[model samples]
Target: MTAVGAPQERAELAPLVTEPERPAPARRSPRRRGRMASWLLYAALAAVTVAFVYPFVWLVSASFKPRSEVFDNKLIPDTFTLDNYVQVWHEAPMALWLLNTVIVTVLATAAVTVSSAMVAWGFSYFRFRGRGPLFGLVLATMMLPGAVTMIPTYLIWNSLGQVGTLTPLWAQNLFGSAFYIFLLRQFFLGLPRELFEAARMDGANQWQVFTRIALPLTRPALVVTALFEFQAAWTDLMRPLIYLRDSSTFTIPRGLKAMLDQFGFGGEWHWEIVVTASVIATVPMIVLFFLGQRHFVEGIATTGSKG
Candidate 1:
């Protein structure tokens, strides 16, 4: 009987040992697999990052390289120089173009920010007849391509005697933009109503509540919207081309094109200067984007939160 009991005990011990060993193997397998997957995900992200970064790297590198070396596809040049920048400065009215762009972008962005915020505040806080329809109209305008209205817009500006002037370029923002209005409206809607109510109880009017409480809380959205407007104004080629007939009034894009035209296709082609101009044109927008990146992301994230 003792021997039989010993055998049964050994059998139970064996089962327990085998069960622990099985879990150990399974756990090891999953851990190894998880590590492999993690590595793969990181690798993929690195690849994507490189893919996006490569173009800007090439553009910057090309700006410093000679025309003959631009198409070499090399990651780094054996020789880099600032001759392109010097030539671009001397040849084109780059400084003037940059100044014009800055003026238009700053004014337009300011107009859009203030007007859009006001409209958004009204739409969100005020109860009025046709409010929903008005907001719908704003959204609907976004669906209409700019190309569709370009000719008509040009004609209207021309009739208003604003053609061939910077007024036409910046005047469009006087009425604000549909997209920006919608964006700001959505952002305004996300604010806590209690804050506004409390402000009202404290003798704060609507304008005071907006200027103090709403604007402060919506800084991220405002910054992002202003940045977007700035970029659009800076990079705009068509509006400037259509409205600006004077070289002195040209924006960077228009100035770049004019430079290309002046150089032509023959021996006069200054690829270095053109490349440098392109780089300079891109720098301000890049700086603005990096500076406002955090706010931009936050604004987009919160824009639709309450809507």
Candidate 2:
């Protein structure tokens, strides 16, 4: 038995090694691909953010621009003037309008939040005949456009002689909005039933269970609700236009409308003042969103999680 030659031995070992199966072509690293994907996503998001934010940025810039330079589509004005803001307060009853808007927004927000929460809690906790039908009926109200009920609502307020007053602006919210009720009901339904049962066993009444336990547990939802109503009431123009006849009674939207009528179209032709007023009107809502963004996002994300 003689030993094999070196070439024969190498050839036999090469077959055993089998060329390491060609190394599978060395795929790109998953981490590198992920990084590239993330960068692209960030770039897309940045573009979208700029698109949404540019108008507002232009609005603020125009508010500082002279009347002749507004609508120039420039992001910054060559000549800056605070005169538009200063003159706006004088040209219109801005202070009074702002105060009126604040009052109405506060009233409307509080009323809707409390009323909607009550109705939602009732729907979530109570077991009764026709409960499902009643809830369905309440929800069905949302399908009807506001125009369908506006005339009848106006007549009701007119019959009560509350027309041309702030009462009509916020009073309608006392009945609990169908949308807010639905939103809050979803949150309430997600709560633990055992908590309410325990509260009852501890001799806490229904109201206590609601105020002490339910409200506290659903603070994020309530904040979301209040923020929504606040923005809605603050930006509401149609109701104010229909109900408020006097300049002194005007909310910010109504006042801005008045400014548009007086300045933007045919009155003074001082477009910068109207732009200034719009910036002022918009700033509060922007501030509010920034302040409550965390709870707003959390509440929206978690609303129907359990329900």
Best by lDDT: 2
| Model 2: colliding residue pairs | none
Per-candidate TM-scores read 0.84, 0.85
Highest TM-score model number: 2
Q: For model 1, how many clashes? A: 0
Across 35-99, the per-residue lDDT of candidate 1 in tens digits comes to: 88879999999999999999888879988887678667777976787778877788878899899
Candidate 2: where is the Cα deviation over 4 Å? 1-40, 299-307
Q: Which stretches of candidate 1 lie over 4 Å from their true place?
A: 1-29, 264-267, 300-307
Tens-digit lDDT track for model 2 on 1-307? 0112346656656545555453332233476886788799999999999999999999999999988899899887989889998999999999999999999999999999999999999999999899999999998998899999899999999999999899999988998998889998988898999999999999999999999999999887889899989999999999999999999999999999999998989667989999999999999999998999997777666655633
Candidate lDDT scores, in order, read 0.83, 0.89
